[model samples]
Target: MPFAVYVLGLAVFAQGTSEFMLSGLVSGIAEDLQVSIPAAGLLTSAFAVGMVVGAPLMALFSRTWPRRRALLIFLTVFVAAHVVGALTPGYEVLLATRIVGALANAGFWAVALVAAVSMVEPAARARATSVVVGGVTVACVVGVPAGALLGEHLGWRSAFWAVALVSVPALLAIVTSVPDDRPRVTAPTGASVAGTGTPTVRAELRSLTGRRVLLTLLTMALVQGATFGAFSYLEPLATRVTGLGAGWVPALLALFGVGSLVGVTVSGRVADARRSAFVLAGMVSLMVGWIALALGAVSPAAVVALVFVQGMLAFGTGSAMISQVFHLAPGAPTLGGSFAAAAFNIGAAAGPWLGGLTIDAGLGFRSPVWVSAVLMGLALIVAGVIRLVRSPQFTKATVA
Candidate 1:
């Protein structure tokens, strides 16, 4: 991996920390801002929404700019948003800050993925993506826990301040390490590859409509929805269903993160080569994992083990599939990144919302796990269809 990819991962670590750290600070934010806990939780939803909306727009607007410049711009705005979030006096202001920060985060993610892949050989797309996604895995393992601990001791605002502080170095490193974008036709030869040198929005949008690209996005959304749907409620499942004490939640989360780190690392090595098999196997494993959680919720040990496995399967599968999106889309790197980001965030937002709905409908916590399984089943069916439809055109288009 390039040193620049590592630096991009560092930037992702800081941004991702802010994304997941909100769970721990919800109570503090609710109490301090005179809002209900549910309202405080909306802050997370707002970020998700921002990501879904901002990604495509940001990518579209920044398409013509150099990748490094776009990255720096996004990080700067992200840092500013964190600073404002820390200093906000009211819930609404804080909410606005979260949205702003999310927009920046989404933009950074959109551009960074394109940048990282462009820096490597076609064969290394999955490995490069894993390096980037690994940052989020690390954030889950270390940054979030540390942020929550920081909030617990110093106050919730401290976590925001810490995110901003950590982001500064990432911004600086990106400025120094990342190179200017060079002319490279991202599309396959003889195709109507958009953005050969200076890509037009119309051309980019056209490229995104390819069947392979659309299918990839749909699969991404479904898989993420299933993953987050179950993940959002893991704490409740652990405490209420599994009979674990409240203190066990953090450990469970860490275990999940560790599993994610392992999964992404391992999958990165071979996903690109055995792309179809990797996806098929991962989706199947994930479906089984979710069903196991639903059936085994009563056993603390089983639930604990399943959480780690599910985390691994979810992230590892996502890393592999995401690499395919760029190659599959052909010629619209920024737009493809935008769509990927939007698809993932749509799932991120929808998963928890759907999970909450199931809980509110008096379907036990296990219902969400079942929901996860169903989503994975849908994804598996889609992946199967995608595999079945692979023609010579498909092979030709994706042949780097």
Candidate 2:
């Protein structure tokens, strides 16, 4: 409910734009740099790799700083990375800039969740988180497409410049909106803060790697991998399989974004009381949506409808998933948060790679949907098994 929470959301919009914009601009970048298309695609891969490593590393190094200061540092660095990305002269330099931008992007994501939750009461954390996570859905709907359009008319560097330009205002918002972190505390009210009394970075890392936690992380990875496997190739599926014109790709993406926004918003309302059930139902619904896409891609209406459902079902699980991490390691909430983030990118990187392999095998575009369905099914099964097998152990092992 605080204005600062929305400010952080604004920051995420800028970060998410940078994260996904490369997908749309890859071809133009390849041509401009005189590099192979695959090499340009590696820029996206570099960003993912940075994100996978950056969150925990940021948590480790920034543990001693005020949260507000840390956030400013992250945002400033992110803004600079985009500037470098916009101005870099060669392919190799651009690749490095992508990595740096992703590092800053990942760093901001980890801290922003902590920042949002820290501003709210325990019971309200999930709802607060939805407000922050909504930025990504909104970005998917708005930023990436706009960046793509800019790239088409003004060249790829202009898209990077556009992101950098938009980010400056968000950066300024944080300066006035977010307060400096208070001294660390473990108050009876369950107020958490940055630094010192907060669990040490090592302990936080150790606590989240337990058997139950690892299983949960795996479930997160599977769910995301499955979804991205299909969703990554959505434009092609829309144009090639559904027989839609190229212009419809943006519309399809926007519809999916709207569905995801609804999913996260609705899920936030129940996450605290029904976290497990929420995630399980989401995975099940996602599986059904993917299956529909696979079996019905030839029907344009079916493809469009199923994608909307898939977007809703897939993102519908996130608020609960994220809140569950904090529950699992209450003392090390930020690190726990990072666990979910890392799992997400790992799955994100793997999903498209797997989907690509499926396509290369001549399984065709629809095959990605099959991949999505299977992954979601596995995630559902994993959730089921964890419920059946790990309940007692999880109850006993929840980090104190």
lDDT winner: 1
lDDT of 2 at 183: 31
Model 1 vs. true fold: TM? 0.94
Give the per-residue lDDT digits (tens) of candidate 1, residues 259-355.
9999999888989898878988999999999999999999988988898999999999998888878878766766777888899888888887888
lDDT for model 2, please: 0.82
User: Ten consecutive residues with minimal summed lDDT in candidate 1?
Assistant: 183-192
RMSD of candidate 2 to the truth, in angstroms, is: 3.3
Estimate every model's Cα lDDT from 0 to 1.
Answer: 0.88, 0.82
Taking all chains together, each candidate's TM-score versus the true structure is 0.94, 0.93
Which residue segments of model 2 deviate by more than 4 Å? 182-196, 393-400
Q: Which tens-of-lDDT digit does each residue in 1-400 have in candidate 2?
A: 8899999988888888888888889999999999999999999999999999987787666766777888889888888887887888799899888888888888788888888888888888888788888888888889989999999999999998888888888888888988787435344444346454665555666678766677788888888898778889998898998899998999998898888888878877878777888888888888888888888999988988887888887877866787777777676766776677788888888898999999999999999889888888788777777776566775676643
TM-score of 2: 0.93
lDDT of 2 at 21: 83
